[model samples]
Target chain A: MLRLPKFEVKNPSTVEEAIAMMHAIDGEARFLAGGTDLNPNMKHRLFTPERVVALGGIEEMFGITQQEDGSMRIGAMATLANVASHAELGLAYPALSQAALLVSGPQLRNMGTLGGNVMLDTRCQWYNQTYFWRSALGFCMKKDGTKCHVIEGGSKCVAAASNDTAPALMTLGAELEFANATGRTRMPIADLWQADGIWNKKVAHTELLVAIHLPKPSADQRGAYGKLRDRGSIDFPLFGIAIRLDLDAQGTIFDAALCAVALQARPWPLKKAAALLCGTKPGEESFTEAVEQVAALAAKQCRPMPNIPGDHEYRHAMVSVYTKRALLAAANGDGPVHHV
Target chain B: MRVFRLQVNGDTVEVAAPEHWTLLEVLRYKIGLTGSKQGCDKGDCGACTVLLDGVPTLACLSLAATVETSAITTIEGLLPAHRANGGEGADPVQDAFDRCGALQCGFCQPGMILSAKALLAKNPNPTSQEIKQSLSGNLCRCTGYTQIYEAVVLAAKGEQV
Candidate 1:
């Protein structure tokens, strides 16, 4: 049995109360809503916080609302099941809903949160390990060691982005609402991330991720997410892609954003691929070319170590496969019109 | 330690719980509800799957303190003691599993049956593909998944296969 290291658990009913407790703990505390990610990490001794602030009681953090302007504000504690099943979200953003539904398994989706998924701890086969295994491996750069075993002599930790929602949200251009004892602020999803594994999120320790706001897609926009995993379900993506394309009245691609997960330290956007779509007609050849370019760039950006689930070559190949599928799904047309 | 209240096997009991103990540990070690087995302590294996608020979730991945107010129906309580004398009866799902020969060593049967019951309750006419997808997280080394899938379908139709 994996016993959690000694810690004090505090349950807070409001965001303000949670923030105050977080402030008092001087960042030694970790806020927990759905313990899906944190509990396992703690069991592995990857983190053993002295105090854990439980956020389950904060009812304000658990619903989805679509404003008059059409943008959706999802409370940080909203379960993945809620996000996947919300009629408004499904009707408006099938891509996001599909991504949410594809995560882990039914049980995990019911328990995990969009907020938790967004803030998912950066994963590495080397880093996301049991204490005994890490001890035998002499520890990795993401945890105890000063140097990274994944890329020896590399300056930064190269933990893979294990999150399923990050790429989907990134494609949707969501904004995150971060709260702390002092105040709250919002930022585009792109700005919220850092490529380096050591400091992936830009938020301060005192700042809690309160909600995720996804701007409604334009009338001409259509999107989809595709994931490739070894197992058909319950496994994290070996490689995954999320595609959001805004088309002109003529159906020509006017703007595009592509994000791939399990590729780098965070959801790595393929600007080159998006650029490739600029003026090209939405067709199979262009999609293939873009997927190829993204695959090559992702391969350059990633160096899969022996610790993760799939081999480096396999994961690299899946990038091309998943990206192509995602682009094709987006081009086929999906929205409220198509009950995805 | 906090005094955690749980509605386990149709009874309400309060026990002192650690801040980070999983529901599996609480059920197995503290309350002595040993029917819910713990295989992979991690969420991967379905050995510790249980119905939390009518949804199947890995008990190994759940914190006991969080489910203090939630309704939990474990395997042991699935069958009422006087099921034979029933006006109100045992779950049809359990009866189907028995008729379909769904267990051998029986280690994974409880969790498998519980997950199936959760699925059939919602989607009474699930396709074979849906049944497999629903049970994908649960690894049953025995039965080879054939009988279990049949059991779920039969149970959903209220038939003894």
Candidate 2:
């Protein structure tokens, strides 16, 4: 059994108390949402915080509610299982729900939180391993050592942003609400990332992600998510795509958005390809031709790297396949084009 | 080390363990309820699954003090609860697994049975997809999952296998 480094746990009833606990601690302290990801990383000797502020006791941060301005407020502590199967949230935003459903496996979805998923660490084959396995290679730049395995002596850590929900949330124009000792602040989800993969988020360690704010969708909005993995369950995506389509009253595409992940440090948005999908009707030859063009463009524009554990060329080929399938699924009002 | 109270197998017990030890460690080592197995000490494998407040939760990932107050139900608690309810020897789910040749190595059955039990409790009549979904987290290397699926379907039908 891999043992976790010794650390004290503090359960706070409120967010303010949680923040206070972190501030009071002298040594390294970290906020723990669900331990689905953090605990494993801790056991792998990736992190050795002296204190952990457990956020499970904060009742105020654990529900799904709608705001007065027709927006939705999803509490950051809501479990992925709840987020995936919640009736109202799924009906309004299927891409987010589908993405949540496709994360790791069933028990992980039950224990993992949405905030944890949004704040997930960038993953790499070299970085995310047991201490002995990693130390044998002298450790990479993301951790204790200085060598860059992914980029071959490159200074920048190129671990891929492996979170599935991020791409879907980006395409849906989701906003994030954060709280700190100072006060509260909200920002667009697309603006939360940086180019560097060692640490991707722009937010500070002290800032707690309070909630995710999803704006009300247009009347004729349609969305879908596609994921390609090695197994049917319990594997992270080798390639993932989120597609959103907006239809005019005449059932013609008025707007579209596409975002993908598992490529690099950030979720790459294909705007030029989205622009090519305008004014096309679903099932028409024009729309089919346009989707093929978008797929081809994605294959050309989006490049897969060998950051995560997979053949880059195979993952590269899957870009167009997933993009075209997800776009068609969105336009046809069908479900996520995922294979079980 | 710290002392805390946990409700496990319908009994309130006080145990002392290290601060960083997960609920799985306390349950298996300190409390001596070894029914909750620990495979892939991380959250990957479902062998450490137990019911917290009647919901399936991964004991390996949950910190001991974080969820110390939840009502934990392990695999050992199932047969006794069934017997208390005036039923036969083992729980129907366990019996179905035994009769259907589902236990090849029996290492993963504890978590698999618990997950299946929770599913049957919520929906007494689950389809093949529902059974497969419920058992997705529990990996069985020996059976290849056909017999396990049959066991769940038989248990759902209220048959004596």
Q: Which candidate leads the pack in lDDT?
A: 2
Question: Against the unseen true structure, what C-alpha lDDT does each candidate score?
Answer: 0.79, 0.90
After superposition, candidate 2 runs with Cα above 4 Å error: none
Cα lDDT tens digits for candidate 1, B39-130: 87877778788998789888987888778878887898788733744725557888888888877788888888888988887888999988
Residues A1-340, candidate 1: write the lDDT tens digits.
Answer: 7777778878888899999888786448888877888888888988878888888898888789987888999999999889988987876676788788888887788789999998888888878789999999888778877878777788887777778788888988899998877788889999988877865888865588889999978877878878777766678877777788888787778788888777678778877777777665576466556656755665565445543578878767556556666777777864211111
Question: Clash number for model 1?
Answer: 0
How far out, in Å, is residue B92 in model 1?
1.7
Encode model 2's per-residue lDDT on A1-340: one tens digit a residue.
Answer: 9889999999999988988998897898889998888899999999899999999989988999998988999999999899999998888888999899899888888888999999998899999899999999999999989999878869898888888899999999999999888888999999999988888999977689989999999888899999988877788888899988888888899988999999888888899999999989887988999999999999998898888877999999988999999998888777677766
**Local lDDT at A210 for model 1:** 88
Off by over 4 Å in 1: A283-307, A334-340, B81-90
Best by DockQ: 2
Tens digits of per-residue lDDT for model 2, B22-101: 99999999999999999988877788999998888899988998878799999999998899899988899999998998
